[model samples]
Target: MVNKAWRIIPRPLLETVLNNHAQHHRVPQPLILHGPRGVGKTTLILERLLGEWNKGPHLTGYIDFAESIEDHHPQFNKSFPWASWSNCPPPALSSCRSKLEHTLESMVEKGVKLGTISSHQIFTTLNKWHGLNTALRRVIQSNNAASKSAVVGKASPSVLWDRAVFALSARCNAQEIDGVLGLSEKWKGLSIEEASYFREAFLALRLAKEVITVQHGWRANAIAHLNRTGGFSRSLAHSCTDWPCLLLELLSQAAEIDHFQPKLVINNIDVLRNATLNDDSSVSASMYHDSLIWRMIALGANERCLPIILVTSDSYYSYQAYLDFGFTDIFISREMFGWTPQEAKMHMVTDYFSPSEWTVIAEVLGPIPRHLFELYALKQSDYYQKVMGDKGSTFEDIVDAYLAYLQITVVNPAMDNALELLKKFAVDARNGKISKDKLRFGAPWRHPPKTDDPTQCMEWAKLQLMDFVQCLVNTEFGDWEETLHSFFALFILLRLAVVGMIS
Candidate 1:
């Protein structure tokens, strides 16, 4: 396994996707991968796709319109190796029409000699014909002449082919098709049949524009044209099934024909509630619903043969929603990323300070993780310099400042209740031979009661007992004897709750 803590891992998931893709002999129509921003969801997807494409003939395209003028225009292209494998362009309007003409002429010449004329034969024959620009034009002219008289001319392969290709190229524009087909001078090896498939697939790309337009109306004209011409029918539709019902239907056609799958991943779902709504309050009301659609599309795509993964933060928003939807297998952060305390400390120190400063910081902050200890140390250091003018203070001075700071700044009136409870426990325990019942006061008790409770009595009293015993053991009278005498005096006054003595 890869170092998941340091980076998002991809190999295991990629193998699963490739196996599924090969078994089905078609790419999944939808897949979703989601997670927190820094957790590397996008990195995982790109690496996995690149790995699979490296092993076989596959095309992978990526579009990150997160910062684009258009909200959802994907950047699509073939992956390497296959990217170098072949080059082909779908029939352009001018080129396809010309090819139909030439093919029809050849078929006519062949028919004249063969003498087997049938309407179905003509349609099927023309459909099967593969030709260049000249052949296409000949086919179109013949079909037009043949259909001049009928109420609605019987749809011929020549007519259907011409119309389909023309409509597709016109809507997509030359620049778009050039990008899609990756046209180059060295691209001449692609067969006419392969070119036709490209044309059909390009049409699917055009249809997918509907999804973009629904969210952003600025692209409406382009979207409408693609939809009318049936151009958006491929991966775009497959990836966008979680969109609106109408858009889903339009994109579904592409999936049906090509078996293209789409995947969705939703991460940081906890932030969904913080998502901004417009003046109309529309986005707010629909945010959860929209999130649901996102997951639904992912689930639907997975079931329809697409691999979908959803990554989420350790937040109730995502956890509760996935649980409610019964998508329990969806991976959580614990599986995606893990860090030991030491590793976490290392990251924090490296991120916030230089290597030379680590030793000094460790001294001040102790062995605790940087999150808890760094701020505490910095604040204490700052206060020491400001109040006592002692930048190079001794440990005793630092401890006294820390206690004072805690009393003055950290413990507010809001903490009065908790302090009172602690004080009550302290006072009760100080009274003669504090019982176990009194010691247990204010402590939380859970089921299967603890047998050996460590916090059963006062810590100060235990320490004083240890000191007295040490005095006895060593037979030392100087400071140890004085300490024992002071402790005994304090113990008697505490039992009596004498105001000036124990307080």
Candidate 2:
């Protein structure tokens, strides 16, 4: 038999949403993909990445805030596949650093009315700076006119910037520098401020060029640091926000470069939540609040005509809230596909265990997942045979074994509380006389009513009592209290009926 364990179920609704994202490049608003654990939210996002959205100018990022990246020792073999920060090449890191430095330098030099700068512009400026730095280093190294010492110390900023362009040309054997520099190249001979502004613009262009090729698709880069004393400050959250903003800027810059608005697909946000929320308890409250920040980013991206797709597992927001956030579409779980209780039972029984074992297994496990059902099923047989083998396979023997397990493992510690509650419920039922209304409404009863024959009420009450007792075999005191209250009410009605018949 094929191991059906690995079978992939197609979630059509998720696929439809992803398809819309890919084709329309529109952001899905308030798409709450909620389900019980093990229902494959993460799996769906991965599939979307590899399948339809593979070719789009989309940058996907995953952040599991629940995992602590800071704890990973620096000396740990950096080449390990799952080594959080080690997967990227040195060139990529160097490129990122250069871009960030250049962008900051450009921003500072242009003094481009800081508030007027779009987040994308800031990101582009940074990336371009890095590319400029790389090109400058290469060009200076290759030029006979510029000695290493002079290049490092006395080289003009414009010259340093040009070297980057030359280096880029030599590496790619293409005039990419011109395309990136755009109108900035025309202001090379202007005033110092003008020159600086143009250079900043040039740096931004170079950064945008590199980002399209160098960055991995759909990978969330989260920076997590723990204070030596073990708490997170507001500074940490701000630092985390910086990278995502840069990324969003990159997407915006891509649209500028291509002159066609680019679409962004934001998925696997839970991964980020898990990463940021992992281990460090101080930032947990902020984790929930971060969704609002993300919503703002989404709206900002949308306003710039960049299509944004945000996929999340949270279902707390109303449709109107999502609409207000500028989400054009919504995909929810109930509106999608999910397993019903009966379907879950059937799937577990047929797919998990043999038919011969299912009945006994279901009796112990009820209708849940296969793993849970199997756990209880295995316990029932092994426990009964080991503890009561000589007694044989009788109903009483099974009940006795179950009760013994309950006493030893489940209710033993809470038995006193359970008995007290049960007694209290019994007294309450005795106090209530047997009127049909009292029988129907009385405390915590589960017995079915006897419409015609009042005498049958006693049998119904006894059966309910037995069920209640069975439920208590391995249950908590609180559960026992509730069950007893119901049975007690029924018993009182039975007593009242008995008195009425005699009168």
Candidate 3:
């Protein structure tokens, strides 16, 4: 059986550069690997690069934000990988976001645990930040009415102290208590502003302590405690800074313990932008900036000298993000390129494709690894069987069939009348109904056609095709204006290939 997806041809030169930047001696600047869709950026990092790096003592973490933001574009056929992978009716953005956040926290915690050499150090840090002593001192230092008379340097432990002690001691008892009653009471004494600040900081510390010490059901217990006490709030959702701070702190400590700066690979980070669009839920754009997740990670990488690689297929979205986050200067970008024809043939599976077959494949698909894979997959599909239907399974036959499949499944679903309009335009040019200048220059796509019957309008077809290319096609194709003619030429070639005119 032919594999639908194949391993990316290793780029020794690119890998060397990546390895140089990913050195453990010092933290490298954040790397943004930008490229067109399906150029093997994800596969390169996840499979080849990470696999090589994992052989060493270094630790690495990865997360894909795209997993949360599904493509809702309608796909008529599931024969091709791209169409099959795109979700029709995507899952709710809110649910997806919640899941992503949880996954991020979980990844952070797991990384911390894996790298932690001393739980005792973690316990001591937790005590210093949010233990009973810290809580009592916080109350004494408060400017609230309840603590007006309390001296910061020398203060007696109030009833709050005794209750907190009991809560701590109860951990050893048959029935364990959270030891937060006194802390929660004192937490309410401060002003609303102070309370919100105090709660996030305190809870973040508490969660870290629980994660390091308890190890199991810590997240559930923490959430249950918050819910039971009505402590969960909207501020904690997006605007929360404490958790992000804690995550960085924990990562730093883990790096210190492991004696090597761990690498962080975050893929499809532009999904932060995607999540905001068309979302009816409470998820907002401000969350990306206000929450310390992205910006904070960048800051942490620079400060701690941790190697952080942020991958995005969408350069425009990332550029906007870089500006909004005020870290345009921090990221060092590397543009991932597709294979060259000479290079592609060197790595091509000669056993599957003879020399002649590969020449035709290369000529049609250019040097794109993804297109080649999709074509290979299409040949083995039921769609291929339907297209071939007792015809010889030649390379040209499969290429023609793939083009037809793309038109019927991907293109037609998006723009129903595009192909028919092209056919009519071709006929119009042949019969002298269309002028020589019009045929040479092609249809003007200045404005969308204003007509009830869009299928009959060539301008509408051109505009619709441009729109589809902009959204569904790879961003590396340059401007839609420039690619418009090349795109139409593909359809024209498809028509010729189907009728055996191309040969």
Candidate closest to the true structure, highest TM-score:
3
Better of 1 and 2 by lDDT: 2
lDDT of 2 at 261: 32
Report lDDT (CA) for all predictions: 0.34, 0.40, 0.51
TM-score of 2: 0.38
TM-score quality measure for candidate 3: 0.58
lDDT of 2 at 474: 45
Per-candidate count of clashing residue pairs (backbone under 3 Å): 50, 37, 1
Residues 1-503 of candidate 2: C-alpha lDDT, one tens digit per residue: 11244334455666776555445433333235443222444456565444444343332333322122334322343211111121112122222223333443343222222112332365434544333344344445654345466566656445565555444444542234334434345646566675445444444444334443233211122222343344544444433343444544444434432223344434423333333333332233343246334533554545442444444433323243346434544332233333444555566555654454456644553332323332435344656456546645543455455446544643333333333333444344455533445345443445244243434554554555456555545463224355454454223322211111111
For this target, which candidate reaches the highest lDDT against the unseen true structure?
3
Candidate 3 has its poorest 10 consecutive residues by lDDT at 494-503
Better of 1 and 3 by lDDT: 3
Q: What digit string (tens of lDDT, one per residue) describes model 3 on residues 260-318?
A: 45666777655554454243233243353335445454455656545667776654433
Tens digit of per-residue lDDT, candidate 1, span 393-478: 54445445544543453233213322333334455445444466533423133111222233543343344334444554465322
Q: Order the candidate numbers by TM-score, best to worst.
A: 3, 2, 1
Q: Is candidate 2 or candidate 3 better by lDDT?
A: 3
Give candidates' CA RMSD values in order. 22.0, 17.7, 12.8
- Model 3 gets an lDDT of 0.51
